[model samples]
Target chain A: MTNEKNKKVVIVDYAMGNIFSVKLACQKVGICAIVSNDKKEISNASALILPGVGAFADAMATLEKLDLVRTIKEFIASGRPFLGICLGMQLLMSESEEFGLHKGLDIIKGRVVKFPAVNDKVPQVGWNQITKPSYSNINWEETLLKGLSEKDFMYFVHSFYVLPNNNNIVVSETNYAGLNYCSSLREKNIYACQFHPEKSGESGLLIYRNFYNLINK
Target chain B: MKNIRIIPRLDIKGPNLVKGIHLEGLRVLGSPEDFAEHYYNAGADELIYMDVVASLYGRNGLMDIIEKTAKKIFIPLTVGGGLRTLEDIKNVLRAGADKVSLNTIAIKNPNIILEASRRFGSSTIVVSIEAIKQNDGKYMAFIENARESTGVEVFSWAKKVEELGAGEILLTSVNNEGTGSGYDIELTRKVSELVSIPVIANGGAGELEDVVNVIKQGKADAVSLASMVHYDYVKKSMVNGSLLKNQAEGNIDFLKFGKISEKIETSGIEEIKFYLKDKGINCRK
Candidate 1:
């Protein structure tokens, strides 16, 4: 029964970003994920990886083409766990300027914007610290962030960041250039991160293990 | 300002650090644990450990090896070689590696980039490509010890890697490695420009000047070298010495501050003109 509960995870692939790593990540935890763009598959799967990468407008356009917006809203409404990665996390925003006007899932009210910087280094590269997590008792320390050191350094390579409308959704943060950088967030069943825990080594791997445990719950 | 990394590469077979005298080569240097501590003490930015041929042997990572490396080294470490599926990546990550890289598998199945990125996180996945310039003037991405070619163009493939959720691109130039000629400048810049993520240059590097030149002229974010650091004729300490000696005279005292201040203070960077006056190192910018 526990194995059955862990069996189904759908990697929503609308051709917007890479959904393979997420699927593989799940597979590592003994779960075989179904990569799908179909509404029925997404809604039916026990868990989902709403993975996205590339320009926000393009991601929105693809989701619209697949008629995914409604299905995602419908699926999330079902209270199943959904995980979004970098751009995956960004697409949950209400709007973005990655090309032109675009709308996101709005599950967490917010907008995604290109990183504010004085230089043309739009994409902040390499590793940095992820420090501030909004909720202290959300099992984050015991789960996703388990093996990581407090203020554990994780890998980051992005030019845009999200501003969640409801501050309560934020789980943790990092900093770059003396500016407060938001790195991770959690709102109910939806969890996200702007940094790569998978690449973060042991601390990062522990985070994945925790996520697996989360969806199983 | 993001920190410009100073890192070292350590190749571990079972327990000791191995240095290759030539390509596909091998020779035990010393305890990897010892070298890792030495590099950390020397102010290296991060560390990378390549299993070399562990996967081909049907061997899993040595837990003792990982524990030793993780316990002694305080910096980030990316482990690569023979990573075929998400499970493989996960096992490595679970053992406490900072990032997992895919090379040969990614060429055969480009989707591996996305799968790993999703399961772990985008920033946790790195696409380590072994590229060689072809007679036709196109750079080709190879896999399985360069036995197979993806038939995909390097620049196009770089874009695909990013699109698929790869956190960064680790590019090694086969033509330039061991020669100390220099990195493939045009190829490095072109790929870096095409991808949104940081591009690391590898293969050819002889001295400290080569590292600076790779970044300045090649427009790369960072460069990686092995023989350059592990050889008898050359060493990491020698390179740093040369880098320090190459600096302009007068602000000689500035060299003493690197340990306490990993980076120059923002205020000092602001009053650059005055600071330069102190060092007397002339700069147009």
Candidate 2:
């Protein structure tokens, strides 16, 4: 609103946490981001960020209470830009098993689950590489992975993920147990990732930058 | 292609990072936020915060710390320790932590991992396994070291973790803890072969050579080290040298773990090292 040339990208902070980083990340890309739990602020914004950092079910409850689920869906449907991070990303799915049968935004026909514990250790902590050459094209289209390469590394810290019922939603993938699992996902106007672009350093910032650019129009 | 991961681990207690020898009597080392920012700048792909005092506190106080660090550090931060149930995982995730890691509880109820993954998807759940080579020379599961034996083969249980919907494995070797003898290559190798998910090798990493050796022998996707990397004890030059040697020999490829660009050269490694150090991160050296 202040700078006509600057795009307005509102970070939908429903007390879901990670509001600050998501906001800062967007700012790094020169996007004028306003962190708000307000529906009006969200509705007026050219772009929306549903930043989430908690359980899938609880996050959904919060979104529902804020009457954001419908608004978010409307934005996506209207071809406006939207991005979901971590738990926010998980909520875009149909449902998650976090607290027993919790429903999701259902924009993408998928489910979220906790990371399985192999005999080794649970919570595959720390940095690991993500790869699957075939997914390079669709994934690159995702603003979150912009300015990165096919083998580019993004930071991850999740116990659950979005399982696209439709593989076309899978933009990029990273292997964990020799199996290629969807990492970043895209569907028309909406985008999401199981990994955190906020914490992925420069590459992560680029993702925010690209997502921000989507709203410039 | 095997993805290569370099992770830095931080054991947090009350917003501060405390690294102890063998997960006991943690000493106040530095700020978790600063350390995380440092590592993120140091080319560390992801960082883990193990709540070493979850048992004493009766809960995982990861949210406050997670939100604090996530604000300053833009990379992924994982929280583990003292998780009682799936609800606990939700609480931490709500608190701004990226993922929830469960260990002791997973041993008590493996279905928790299965249930969470079945509903939420598998990539979010991480199961940490504490393995000890028993007197019989066979690996057995432990919660906080060999305190309570699960009487299960480490590698066998690793397979179970994957089946239960775990996204990745955090493998720590009790025999290697505090010893600085390098990683438990055999344990890493065995688990790597057992599960197809990414495996993170923790517990013992004395130097840059140890880091390279662990990934090479174990075929692990990532190497997670705490004190060695966090305290600046491991020299950045060594890490650069090691990575260069590995790359030159074709021992590893850049894209295995996801590189923004594979522009790193044996010679360029030094330049990147300086970039990281200038950013105030604690590296392997």
Candidate 3:
């Protein structure tokens, strides 16, 4: 991992995310991350990170304008490690119902839906604990949950959540206002978390470390 | 369950960090970088940098400080004060700030919230409301560092900002600010309950209990502190004249003569978290 070739990670920049914080987070973990919208740079990277913080429809429009949608699909199809954060994770779903109907990357069979108008806050901002599936036999310690406790808190700021058709891909869940929502998902080489690891303090940094280690493995 | 965020709000006047009583009589503390790093190391959930005199000084002047801190500090950095235009917000975000908080400008032009939120997402936009309790018990929103009243009620204004697409609300009590008496629980609770977005309680947190009360009773999602964390540090530094040296060189030493310290010990972020945890409050350990 110390070698220059193995230390590179590309953060997809479609002009709609906290690219700076994502790059800084990767740098904190000893990974040289480049924020690029170029297909060549993204495709040539060792691992790709998709980070976002905005409306899903607007993000999709920007990605389409940049013509990086097909590029992302090809990169993910290559079986390389891919990680998505927050809205970036939602973009992989089939569609989103934020303001109106919108299509997503459709790499995963899910739809992004707004949280039901309950008594809880709309965005569900701040730090919330992530709880792993109770009945799953999968060892989360070997993956992104490595070096993290079962209920460790992570920073989150989102008004919508992803509802995947397949529960097996769901890695962890978080409860807000007595409602359980998907917090993270894992499907082979592709991983995504709704929380912001870069902003989650030491626990967040450890998550990034684990993701980096996964890439190395 | 989401854990309450503990934030260290640093009020900056030029390069030096300063604190005031009731938002008056400014006293320079140590460097912003040092205090930021110290709080980050001690386990702060987030940081808010408010340029106290940015409006009076003509522009947002913490870009260098923000850049320096953003390079090492990984937590979310929110910058407030003197951010009026979309370009100013862009520059701050480009300098590595995660969020840009608006106050006076938002009142002057409410469409900025809509436009900025459209350009940079709602989560990146925060509306800071400084509320002062009026004679009739209603809280009125004040802008320009709480120097002028907007004649707008805090509750309706917060709701309006949320409707205008603001991601978060930072509600500060002008009466309780720098007093270290405690948060205006009623004011905080009123605003927090009125808005659907996350509300951050600012002004008046004297101890850990005060923070707990604000979260439990006031229902604030996050708590911001300046005097609670920096008062002792600024007081001690003033007495020892260690802070005076930095000011002397900058010709800003006249801001230090009013306050003195009798207390020697200051609580760090860790201590505050521990105290909160002991009271059965869930905070990041």
Question: Once model 3 is optimally superposed onto the true structure by TM-score, how far is the C-alpha of residue A59 displaced, in angstroms?
Answer: 1.1
lDDT of candidate 3 over A63-134, digit per residue (tens):
999999999999999998899999999999999998999999999998998887786777888888888877
Top lDDT model: 3
Q: After superposition, how far is residue A62 of candidate 2 from its true place, in Å?
A: 14
Sort the predicted structures by lDDT, highest score first.
3, 2, 1
Going through the candidates in order, the fraction of native interface contacts each one reproduces equals: 0.12, 0.25, 0.64
Model-by-model DockQ, in order:
0.10, 0.22, 0.66
lDDT of 1 by residue, B118-213 (tens): 656676788988788999888988775455677877888889899998888888787776565666888888888777677888776655555656
Candidates' C-alpha lDDT: 0.65, 0.69, 0.86
Question: For model 2 chain B, where is the 10-residue window of minimal lDDT?
Answer: B259-268
**Per-residue alpha-carbon lDDT of candidate 1 for residues A150-210, written as tens digits (9 for 90 to 100):** 5665656677889887766677777664567568888777878887655454455567677
Per prediction, the TM-score for chain B is 0.77, 0.79, 0.91
Clashes in each model (backbone N, CA, C under 3 Å)? 21, 66, 0
Q: What TM-score does candidate 3 reach?
A: 0.92
lDDT of 3 at B31: 84
RMSD per model, one decimal: 12.1, 10.6, 2.8
lDDT of 3 by residue, B63-178 (tens): 88888998878788999998989999998998889998999999999999999999999999999999999999988999888889888988899999999999999999999887
Task: Enumerate residue pairs that collide in model 3.
Answer: none
